[model samples]
Target: MARYGMQYGPPQRSRVPLVLVAVLGLVLIVILAVGGVLLYQRLDEPDSAPPATKPSTADAVEFRRVLKSEQGQCPSPPSDTVVCDANGFRYTVGRVELNGAHVTEVKAAQNEGDPTWHVMLNLNSEGAEAFTRLTTDLAKKQPPLNQIAIVVGDQVVAAPTVQSAIPGGKVQISSNYTKKTAEELARRITG
Candidate 1:
């Protein structure tokens, strides 16, 4: 006859099931992490819809007089004047000399004597008169004051100084522009 023996600690168990469960959990976590990254990437992409035919009122182009200007950010609570930025400078702009409504045509062209591109705007008769008067007045003033800020929305695309009274309704804006940039600006102005 043989004597019966008792187990001291826990009974023996296979570790295969536990390992399988752990592996499944790790795979689930990996799948969730990958899905999250993919979802984030998809959400970050820009909308693929076409742009609107007409620009909103806030996006309409305008030419304004530079009232006060500085080499840094515009002041808070800009007061009566609107602030515009161009070429690393901030300008306090006043008075709309011309607006998008007066623009008859917009084109991108190369500079006369330079290898740079520019956006050219042809304006209506009323706009021509207004621009002429504005340029005439500004031409007589000193620095910062002599500049005409070409604004699109609240941003200044260019702030060219009035060397002399620019006669006619044709205006050209040059800001070290590439062909693509000039064309893009023309399109924005046209819209």
Candidate 2:
């Protein structure tokens, strides 16, 4: 007897479309991953944008003697002295021991084995003599008087205490500064 209805095996479905979809998904994931990495790298780079305030050619840098310093608010109408704040302390500054004109070069540099950064100022012959005298006197003093306030445009950048007389004209100002801050300070002083 002949079979009325024909028996057929399972119909084969093409897997090309499914394979294409999977390949496209993989490609998309790789693209997204690469994009994310590139974005992160760009963001991780050091900031090269201009400073908040443009530095002028006449930006003044003064190394002044700290006559008296206190940790509280600065006195209003200071008497025969300039009051400047640095690191939460107010310094009563006296005559300028050194000025910007004495500086020949300024640059930011990192310490040999330290993570902190600093600004180095190279001074002229006159400045070196004056600085030596100032440091020698300050080293013999006590407390606030032993510190020298580095004033830049009315703002005190650092007030480093003098441990001994520095005879050379090379001066390094180190504080709680990052690489960016140190570079900015160098630029401002140079300008």
Best by lDDT: 2
Clashes of 2: 0
Provide the TM-score for each candidate, comma-separated: 0.63, 0.65
**What's the CA error at residue 113 for candidate 2, in Å?**
2.6
Per-prediction tally of clashes:
0, 0
Model 1 lDDT tens row, 112-137: 46667887777779889989999999
List ranges where model 1 is wrong by over 4 Å: 1-59, 74-80, 111-113
Candidate 2, superposed: residue stretches over 4 Å from native: 1-59, 74-80
lDDT of all predictions:
0.78, 0.80
